[model samples]
Target chain A: MKYLDEYRDPELARRLLSRIEEIAPGDRVIRLMEICGTHTVAIFRSGLRHLLPSTIRLISGPGCPVCVTANEDIDRAIWLAKQPGVIVTTFGDLVRVPGSTSSLNVERSNGADVRIVYATIDALQIARATPDRQVVFVGIGFETTAPTVAAAVKQAAAEGLVNFSVLPVHKLLPPAMGALLEEGNLQLNGFLCPGHVSTVIGASAYEDVVNRYGISCVVAGFEPLDLLHGIYLLVECVVKGTPQVLNQYRRAVSRDGNAAARRLMDEVFEPADSTWRGLGPIPLSGLRFRNSWRRFDAGERFSMPVIQVREDPACRCGDVLRGLMEPPQCTLFRKVCNPQNPKGPCMVSGEGTCGAYYRYHTESL
Target chain B: MKQRTVQLDQGSGGRATHELVKGLFVEAFRNEFLLEMNDSALVQLNGGRIAMSTDSYVVDPVIFPGGNIGSLAVHGTVNDLAMRGARPLYLTAGFILEEGLSLETLEQVVRAMGEAARESGVLIVAGDTKVVPRGKADKLFINTAGVGVVPPGIHVAGQNARPGDAVLINGTIGDHGMAVLCKREGLAFENEIRSDSAPLHDLVRQMLEVCPRIHVLRDPTRGGVATTLNEIAQQSSVGIRLLEEALPIGEDVAGACELLGLDPLYVANEGKLLACVPADEAEELLQVMRRHPLGAKSRRIGEVTVEEPGRVFLKTRIGGHRLVDMLRGEQLPRIC
Candidate 1:
């Protein structure tokens, strides 16, 4: 709690809140988007939104990897789970996410040998232990998680674990940000970049967004103080009409990010056009195994049948992820969808915008 | 499509489990005793009031850091009886063993159970054992049922909680949960986390002596402090507001929860108990609880409120507040 407790000090938070209120312009409404699922949850968990000035509107973007993952990819993963002698391993976040037809949780209950692992290394270890069975790891996340998966893949290749393979659905943060700006309908004043992802890709990663869209970007940590400070920085940028990339989480994020992690990612994967659940297909927004490591790719290793993907028409998860609609605005928000019986990934994943809103903002609604 | 079957989430002691219980078990077994829905059922037997409770232990890796499944089974049942201000007296245990389990492991488990029962001043009055094929059951499973005598003038139930009642918890949360998780997953940290799997009968006894007017006494076990508090809130039709800074959590457990993307409030605790007492008597009860070995780290976590009836809120470390909803399913780790 050494590093964390200090950041959560009420005294410090009050000072920062006061400072933000003083600088925030009262003439017009200022809209800011937090493009990270973790940030969205953190904001809600701390009830920070209620404390912020009403004029500054914070919107949740498609930062949750689980929420943005396309139904086709989930269907593909479900197909792999059903394969004979295959053990499908995935992060816990993806197990409850519904695919086109079924979910991993349902498959598991039907005895499909599905396992939830905390890290990719655990999947590798499972593959190493069970030589007779094939282990398909469903790799999902942004840059913050891709390095660890890449490291595991490299370790698997070095150990020559032929039974181990990955369903690479890893996404890049900056490309999605670019896509969001290109769509040009969010009408955002500033952006609160993810801290962990920024640690891997750095504050410099958002320079392109700021340069291209002339939007203010502030790299932020997940703590209350970090978020408030990040908001104050963005507010300053908005007041001065100067769009720039700033780093408020200097302790964790650097300008250039972690070079070693980037090197590892480049060695194992290359940017490929991938489909996002809400944003549709974006060029170079996802990572795929390089030719050298292609053998470890589950998509290449297994003979997968073509999957017909479908989305629930009633679930406005696409609009929710795009920051076009709030969770309660969806017709199925708490009526047809909830944490107990989620109709979309936004309600399934903990960090999903809808899930966070439902968990923290239910009373207000 | 496959026929609907029981998934692991149904046993997670969260929303799914609640639904399954209400939709099936409670509907079929509708009775006044079952309707009360306290941890243990209070029954009048032989012109005397007694607490009756039953629990089953199927924890994976039967042997864990602080205790084994055998000890856990004993503690679980004994604590349930103690929750009703009952002096746990007798217990019954049933064991389902897998065919290839070593006799040494079985003996160790049984011995641990015996020791725990003895420590809690309870006798293993009756028991049975059965064995299944290697894959039919896990290494071992234990089911325990217990009965205890409730003293006169002692009235404690979840529904007894009222507005202006103070909520207090003994020691830290998330120890047992994190310990089991780390041991099972082979996750190592700088400091090893050991499970807080101990009987709370002695502590509860001490607490009642100081304030027999204790409103509610329930162990924050499976779905943890959060879920247990939610149950109390709904049962009593009052709101509970927890102080984020007041909730005591072990450093190692906190670190592990942070690493695993788990909330300590929702994590399980084997030996912890939540007591709701009249606001004025709270400090006296806390003083008594702190004298007991198990309650040395006790703190006043929250207070029952009239606002937002049947809801629980947390006053965050910052000057913000958020609703602490019941666990939806199992607490799943987040993707970074």
Candidate 2:
């Protein structure tokens, strides 16, 4: 708890809060978006949202993997889980996410072999253990998790894991971020970049974003003080009309990021146009297996009949993901779409905007 | 298209557990003897008040750092009876053994159970055993039933917590759960985390002697302190506000939880108890609790509130507040 406890120090937090207050826009409304599911969770978990001045509004972006995962991919994963002699593995968050027809959890209860794994390597291990069954790992998340999945694919290829394959739904942060700025739906002052993702892609990854959009971008740690300090840096930048990518989480993040991780990711995967649930299709935002690694790609390895993907008619998860609409503004938020029976991806994951709002927001919906 | 079936969350002893208990079990087993649901059944036998409780242990890797399933079984039942303000007197153990289990392991488990019972001054009055086919059962499973005598003028229940009452914990949170998880999953750390599993009847006895007016006594077992507090909140129809800085959590346990993306508040604890007492008597109760070995690290964590009835909140390390809802499902190690 050495490194963690210091970041959570209440004294430092108060100091940072006061600093942020000084730089905050007094009479004008400022909107800052945190483009990471982790940041959304940390903000809510520490009740940091409540401490901020009312002039600054924080919005959750399309950062949650489960939230942004396209419906077709989810439906495909469910289909794979149902196929005979196939074992579907995914993170716990994705298990509860509703697909076009059924969730992985529902399939599991009806006797599908769907396992929840903490790491991509666990799926590889299961493949190694079971030679007769095809093990499909549902790869999700941003740069922070992409490298690990890439490493697993490389390991599987090296080990000649015939039973192992990955259904790659991995996404990049920069492209979606560019899309968000171009949409002009939500007027944003700055951004708090994801800490763990920044550690992989590096703080410099956002430099292009800053240069193009002329917005304050600060990479922040997930702790409350780290976030508050990051907000202070952003507010200071906005007040001074200076847009620069600053790394507030100096301990873990760097300019170049983990170079070896990038190399590994580059070797196993390639950027391709893929669909997002709310954002639709964004060019070069999705990751796919390299041609050499296609044998280990679940999408290529399986030749199954296509199922027509259907989106919920009333769910406004698209606008919510873009920070254009609050979760409560959506008619299905707490009425039809809830954590127990999520009609949309935003209500599925705990870090999703709707789920966080449903949980931490004390006011009645 | 149809209603979802009962899942594992229903068995986690949180809100879902309450649902399963009230929505199904209580309705099916509707009787005066089973309605109290105060850890143990408070019944009158031959004009004397007695408490009875039973629990089964299916912890994976039946053996752990501090103790094994054997000791846990004994400690769990004894503590349950004690929670009802009873002096634990006797216990009965039943064992289901997998055919392939080694006698050496079984001997070790039985020895630990015997030692725990002896230390707690609870006699194992009767026992039963059965051997199952290899695949039908785990290596070993233990079920223990206990009976204790309740003294006059002692009535403790979860529904007894009141607004303005103090909430105190026995010791550090999540130790037993972490110990078992580490051992089961083969996780290693610089400092080895051990289970805090122990008989708490003696500690409860010491507390009752000093303050018999204790409102609620609950072992924050399966769903940890958050779920336990939420249950107390709902049952008592009061609010509880916990101070994050005041909660006693072990350094190693906190580190492990951080690494695993788990919240210590939601992690399970086997030997810890939450005591709700009058605000004025809280200071005196702490002194008595601190003297007991199991309660040496005891501290006041929170106070019952009337602001938000049937809710729990944590005054976070920062000057912010968040709701501590009931455990919904298996607390999956989060990525965020």
Tens-digit lDDT track for model 1 on B281-315? 99999998888899999999999999988989998
Candidate 2 lDDT by residue in tens digits, B229-262? 9888988899999999999999999999999888
TM value for model 1: 0.93
Cα lDDT tens digits for candidate 2, A1-365: 77888889999999888888888878898889999988998998898888888888899999998899998999999999989999999998898888788888888989999999989999999999999999999999888889999999889878888899999999998999998899887789999999989889999999999999999899999988899899999999989999999999999999999999999999999999989888899999999988888888888789857889988778898888999898888887778777767788888887898888776666521
RMSD (Å) per prediction: 3.1, 2.6
Interface alpha-carbon RMSD, every candidate: 2.3, 2.6
Return the DockQ of model 2. 0.50
The lDDT values for all models are 0.91, 0.88
Q: Indicate the DockQ of the complex predicted as candidate 1.
A: 0.55
- Please state the error at residue A317 of candidate 1 in Å: 0.4
lDDT of 1 by residue, A1-365 (tens): 88888888899999999998998778899999999998999998988988888889999999999999999999999999989999999998798888888999889888899998988999999999999999999999999889999999889888988899999999998888889888989889999999999999989999998999999999999989999999999999999999999999999899999999999999999999999989999999999988988888898789677888888788889999999999988888889788877899999998999999888886552
Question: What TM-score does candidate 2 reach?
Answer: 0.95
**Candidate 2: segments with Cα more than 4 A from true spot:** A329-337, B1-6, B332-336
Classified by CAPRI criteria, candidate 2 counts as medium
